[model samples]
Target: MRSPLRTLVPLALWLLCLPALAQDYVPSRDAWSHASPSEAGFDPARLAAAVDWARANGEQAPADLRDALMASFGPREPDYRILGPVGTRGPANGMILRGGRIVAEWGDTARPEMTFSVAKSTLSVVAGLAYDDGLLPEPDQRVSMQVSGPWFEGAHNGAITWTHLLHQTSDWSGALWDIHDWADRPDGDDPANRVLHAPGTHYKYNDVRVNLLALALLELQREPAPQVFKRRVMDPIGASSTWRWEGYENSWITLDGLRMQSVSGGGHFGGGMVINTRDLARLGLLMQRDGEWNGQRLLSSDWIARALVPSRVKSDYGYLWWLNTGRTAIPAAPERAFWAAGFGGNHVYIDREHDLVIVTRWTPDLAGVVTRVLEALEQP
Candidate 1:
């Protein structure tokens, strides 16, 4: 017969296990909580303030332009919702301007949020600043000369130039799409890393290739990439927001580690930047002005020209920037346009012909948000 103590102990263990099996189930609100306009950084009052300023300063839009701007926020006969489709639905936010004035703006301008691959286009501005400052070598200089490490040991690897990296034509073989698979391999730096389909042969979008550009910048400056970015680009543009470049660490692991690593700024899209919409608009405006702001030349006009011009890979892609017009499945307006597009619906649309800019943000979705927004702009 079992001792009384043993019988009691088993009974206690069973009681404890019951609670473990019946633990309360609480659903996660991470994504759902973000759907609110306040959470996304929107305040109707702030928009009113901007409108008031525009009115007082003679910067307001005409009635027709205002109607066009409002139509962009919803799906109508012409599909004019400005926010597009957001949060697996449609675009969450949008902005519109004409003649260098804020015609229509919406969503949270104060929310610091993720802009996805759009950050890549912004990175080009940082590189431009470095070039203008003489901190970085000419685009034609070989990577081997700029960086010192085992990675640059071979002739071909060493011969890879900044221009090659910018154009996504670097002879590096690893695909940006496959970075996660290769990142954790025991031999991350194997010779296979240098494999490529002939340099400049094709246009393949790769995050590691872009990250290497960041690494190259780090090697040149001996400082963190974010620091260089702030000093060179953010501060000059008067972007008052907190942003950080994502990276690996022990204490905290990102929800999507691999996806984060592939981005130009190492992922953590929100951490990569948390700027208000207005600041983003200002940056777009500065680019529209050819890298000059407030009469100060932030970057050489020549550099801006190079960035806006299409590359060999596709008519749509320029050094990190996305050219809107030319040859693409997306319909192009007669006016040449370029954009900085992020995952989700984050966008900085620049129209050179009309001197206009449209900025927007939205939750993650792969729908034809880009095409829709462009169509909205084409409205008479």
Candidate 2:
């Protein structure tokens, strides 16, 4: 039998959170409600200063993202070249949301730009949706059990579970889309000969491994991952139709006699999410509300909690999301805060304690941005 106290504890917390949830403003498709800085309990002058700082601190990458990609990663990885679509980036822009309404915005918030590794966080949501739909029952189950393929056939690879892949600790060695796992941020001079660690025992940020996750998800979903994402999450959240998720030229495969692209998890080889700041803010807001939107639960709260839990090997990382644990990643933010960060400085920060969602684009100083935003909040 379950303890009475255990049952009542959750009930009590839900009751306490009810009023706050009721007070939140949900935006419509046509327009987002706005609140002045003073109305949102922020210091107006300080908030203005934060926006100015963000505008002045845009990342130094060239506007031509193809050039930027070559300049940033070409020298580090062998045979580095883009195999997917690339686009010219826009200038710095972002928005600050408090209580689910816009409090401040700057620059071209409507421009859709490539969001690199931030797509990883969105991919995590896609995985969670699969888990909720009963397609994926256990996160700790071996990948080989769900789908039979050469990717997970080896001794080390076969041992990997969904949890390991989600945490970026699988260290699954292989090449997908002709890109070797060792070629991504490899060690020393010879990347191809890099040593491999046991599954779930090491943490390495590799796009090849991430793309493998996408492929695995594609196989399980039996349709394009982006289609699932659009139908399930984005549509329910009222996200604009402008956002697009792309995969590489070679990433397409026939599934169930249907040809569909397996979307890349980041823009390392070029394709990921191309979205505006507002749509990004909507994603952050969904996370801030624990996967609920306008009283409808698009994603399970349990999944959100699980996704935000720090991985054993990396405290600052949780299911592809970046955490502010130990105040290391964002010193000025609350400890419970977490975010989706991409290459080229895009971010979608979720601060539940403050009922805040902050989205930044092409801004390198994430820590400074958080500090300035927090400093602008009115003191009790």
Candidate 3:
């Protein structure tokens, strides 16, 4: 129902042998590459029909998405300094990529907007970068083992591992950026509920805890997470620079005598990822190529493999990313097909079987999107 353990796990053993060369791809279009639907063996009309379904019947999840936040955070959370209006969603937009080329698109694909939890996927990539640089000693190694200082102190928090944080199962109890782990989506009505569990024992989608993960990673890297991501992952992948990852004002900490911001895992507290669909599509394309953009290995297939595999607590969720499992999330998608989903219907679907990457924003028809895209690829 959500998204780790501690051991001095050996580092080298965790590194799986990946293909040395991941073919590099260049974008034909500045925004993205383009291809005819027929080039990908897809029916143009069927694809349009699917896009039409989304545009015609799509919905905004309503202000309750923010109403709950406002209620929980008091009009607006004070620490959420770099956020947007409560419950903001842009006009519907989407893009389809096949063979790393755009097959179709609609709406204002370039307008950046809040992407909610998809920031977790972005964070996942940063984690991948950390591993690639050998900063993370081991995936199963305790976060406490890597990060030092009062931030990750305490036996309960010390027991949590990187794998647990990635899977949203760490159950790390703490308040970061003024957002309490228990204040968000409590299993019951009590907002002040104090039933905290041990680390890695439960699965809960707590942004406060996720933010803790961001902070811990920040301390471990001793740099702003966004800059590291930009230099290591996004720039190499040629993603748009307009996209921004937000962090709370209070989340700022001076590291190595330099001030830095620790970005949150998602927009639950208002500060998260604000990115355009084209940028998101680029991200999907990178993932579709199995952590390769064209051919340069920006992300290791080893990390991607672990990131996509289902976690122990949630069958339909992988490490921060969502998986198509148990016929939930997207029954129309293949089991191997995974997606980076955000609140308000934002999705970056990775259909490796079809070499397809689809990104949709603020649409209610994920099933229609998947079904239509798959149907088009099947047509004569």
TM values, all candidates: 0.63, 0.94, 0.86
Question: Residue by residue across 1-380, what tens digits does model 2's lDDT show?
Answer: 98979966764564355343334568887789888888777899999999999999997458999999999899989899898899988889999988788999998888889999999999999999999998889989999999777999978999999989999999998889999898888788787887888887789998888889889999998978889999998888889999999999999998788889999999999999999999999888988888888889989988888998999999999999999999888878888899999998899999876778999999977888989989998841
- Point out the higher-scoring one by lDDT: 2 or 3: 2
Q: Per-model C-alpha lDDT, please?
A: 0.53, 0.88, 0.76
Q: In candidate 3, which residue pairs get closer than 3 Å at backbone N, Cα or C atoms, i.e. clash?
A: 3-167, 3-168, 4-164, 22-295, 23-294, 23-295, 24-294, 24-295, 25-294
At residue 134, give the lDDT of candidate 1.
84
Compose the digit string of candidate 3's lDDT tens values, residues 163-237.
899989887766666666665665565646567677666788878777887888887777888899888777877
Model 3 RMSD, rounded to 1 decimal = 7.5
Residue 306's lDDT within candidate 2 is 91
Positional deviation of residue 13's Cα in model 1 after best superposition, in angstroms: 86
Model 2 TM-score, all chains together: 0.94
- TM-score leader: 2
**Where in model 3 is the C-alpha error above 4 Å?**
1-25, 28-31, 60-88, 189-193
